[model samples]
Target: MNIKKENDKEDNENVEVFDEILDKSFIESYDPSIIVENQVTTETNYGDFQHLGCYIICVLIIYEFLLLLLMGNITFLIFGAAVPNVIGCIGENKNYTFTENGCIKLYEIQKNESCIPIIENQFESIQSEYNLYCKEAENVKQTSAFLQMFAMMIGATFGGQLSDNFGRVKTIKYSLFFIIICCFLSSYATTIEVFNIYRFLGSIFVGTKSSVLHVLLLEYLPKQHRVWVSTIFSFSPNYIIFSFMAYYTKNWRDLMFVISFIGLIGLILINFVKEPVRWLIQKGKLSKARQSMIFIEKWSGKLTDNMEKKIFDYIEEESFKQEESQRRKKSYTFKHLFVTWKLTSYSLFFGYSALVGCFINYALIFNLEKVSGSIFMNTAYLGLIRWFFNISVGILDYYVKWFGRKTCHTLAMVTIILTLSIVLLNIYFPLQQQYIVRFATLFAISMCSQIFIANSVAQTELFPTSIRNIAVSFQAVFARLGSIVAPFLFGFQSYSLTLPYLIMVTMSIVDLTTIWILIPETKGDKLKDHLPNKDEWIFGKKNRELKLLKKVELEKKYGSRCN
Candidate 1:
């Protein structure tokens, strides 16, 4: 007995020695005090663990950098959709209405004088260069918006699939490379058609970079930080950049060049980004996973030996589960999304909510130029409200479990409805109150946008790993859909500014009703493990049949060898 006991002890010692040499990893994913007394425990040095927090912060910084860049691309619509208002110059003839169609500024080149189309400051846009005005103006702008959204949808659909098939880092690298190329080429386009094409193609690149980039950081972050990341990732707006840069970059070409350059910088910086160890394990790339774990552990600082074993063992078991899943059955496909009950319900409603959210967000942004002050200052205020609210929600989520996600989601919608109603009602009050109402509308927009972000954690949680990429990416699809239609809805301004607000208020009410019925609280659920039998239902697995079939296969394979 002593000999056997010594052998077991020696085996354990050998494993620990191997870990020390190999630098195997574990997480301080939980508080150290929660560990069982029988298990190995480590001293908590807040000073030492600060490095771990800083490392994660570094990851978040890189993540937000990429997100901000892609957001810069996604928000190109804010400018493109504004081209109609900004592109018009004084017509030479003043008789453009007689010959041409509606609302066109005619530039006639008399004798020796040059035909200067619409020149705003020192720069001109593609709309001016192509003379895409009059009846064609709205169509051109709407087409650009639609094409951008359509391309984004395609990129997101595939980006998610590729993130699942390859890895997050790989998807981002390829997508951003394509974006840089398209944007650089678009900058040099002499014609409107070519510029529009490039913009459409470039949006695909940004779409591919969107969901997966955020997911990479998400897998590495803890629960609290995940909310922080989610809020930032979801509420991304490039209005601040536009607000400031517009003062310098009056030329469309220069703007494209600058945006492309940022994308190139992201491509270079991405080299330092490590793929999540969870993804590596799922791919069955254990060697790469081990290396990533080493990076994580080195950053996380000293861990208990037992905790190290526990973390690694958990990873290894999950990897084995992935392999077993593949061997036992065919992988789940997109078709499985609609067939499942709860998933179908959640996806449909969330997608619609996302659609409404995007429309409302863009509708507000498209009208920034019309706001009665310095456009840059107005834009900056919108961005600041979003930031302040982002921090507010993150702090609230971390400190208080006051309301479940469902309740919070409903509350946010109701708040927007109430605030918007006040703004509308303020129209009847004195002129003094009208200014406050305008500010109130901005506040309402910020609150609505924040809810969309704070709820993103539910997206990553509700679906199984099998569908998470597409599930999250799918929300982007609907978001882009809303973006596509927003400018057209803003076209209602040709009738009355209040017309758009009236339509939005009606839509918000519908969205609130749908969300309440279809959505459930995901506030307390554990990430990735909240849903039961996800693997089974996701792959259309029924318990008894799968068990019986597995039993038959196992007996056939092993029975003859045993005999």
Candidate 2:
């Protein structure tokens, strides 16, 4: 069988020789989806199992550790412990003012008087420690939350640069180290200013490590094994644990310390792992790439001599291709994402979807008080529901061929809109049963979680390896941007109860439009390692017809056996 090119004699010769080499071992050692237009993608089949356990565990622990800190702080402020009533207040004028709840309103205080704050119990929380109560204190709380998310946005950008330039594993390790130190310092903060400072510092690494580690894990796993990402990587179960811990500890400082200690597990586990082979090869570290392959072979105990030889041959070929591609173009950065029209469109579409998804996700959580239920129980329910949906979405993404990434993402948005609309219905036509209202609220938020996994997998698969982390990080930056703004709009409830849900519905519509129009069906597609060229634009209709025709021609010549 001839699998040679006809346009160029030189190319035909190269293809003939390459096909000869692949005939030896490609059928058994690699996924054939990697072959396209004479460009070979190097992927190993053995290392996924070896790398998956440690990768998932390490990411899960560290990711949940950071989220636990964020969620615990929010939960403590929203649903506080028992509050002591003030019996009396001592004035700065040496006069005593008696009042219920132990104090006079700030507005009622005389020019020469000051209200002394009094407390009965030693319940430790940000509000109690910093006296973040009253109308003016709301601004401080908002600012603190804003700063934490702002730091995260900057960290996402910085982390992507570090990952693409230095390597994913190194960036992850350094970020985790800083996170542990800052978390400890934040716990011991003596003042609000000091506490916010340490938290801001820690959040930077939180954003950094989260993006880098996720990209690393995605790179390590094969396309087929990515189902685990949505399930194990959900880490939502940690939410239930966090709720229980917060209830039992009842001290914000203790909670922070606990989360800090948990981060140590991820730090330890990551030390045992190495850089992914894909990342190593992309960066032109052929020697290191080969070493990584050997390491995986040892771990999996499945790389026979023949399989090893085939793997090395593929790696050697990919290395030569990488060198040639690099000579044609320089190293990739975030700017490259927009260099081509196709790249720009994909980047913007996914980035916008991420922003909208995250906004709706946090908005619903912040608005959880509107639902009629215990906050702790509601929080646990959110986690469990999200976990179950994560697994469901993963199975559909991997097994259900027709339910592609675009369809799944579109379904999630539709579900959110429909559920939130039900919540809206309760506003105009109040639901007699409070449980129905509560269910809609929880259901809306839980379904929105699916968007995160769907958008992430689609972005990773569609983007090339050269700028893969940057693409993911670009989306993270947008997601963090949404999170930063969510709290401010969370106050829309004060103006009108229906306003928040209305906003979410509107955003969901916008997200659904993007998915239907811009996003592609990427379920069974190969992961490209080079930047896209003309006629390969994700939204190029003409390109699709050309590809289809080419595929038909090849099928007629090679028969189905080529597949």
Scored by TM-score, the top model is 2
Candidate 1 lDDT over 469-512, as tens digits, reads 77778887887788778868867757885677788789889988
> What is the Cα-based lDDT of residue 159 in candidate 2?
86
List runs of model 2 lying over 4 Å from the truth: 1-124, 134-137, 534-563
> TM-score of model 2 relative to the true fold?
0.77
Q: What is the TM-score of each candidate against the true structure?
A: 0.76, 0.77
Candidate 1: global Cα-lDDT? 0.65
Error of 1 at 149 (Å): 1.3
lDDT of 2 at 146: 76
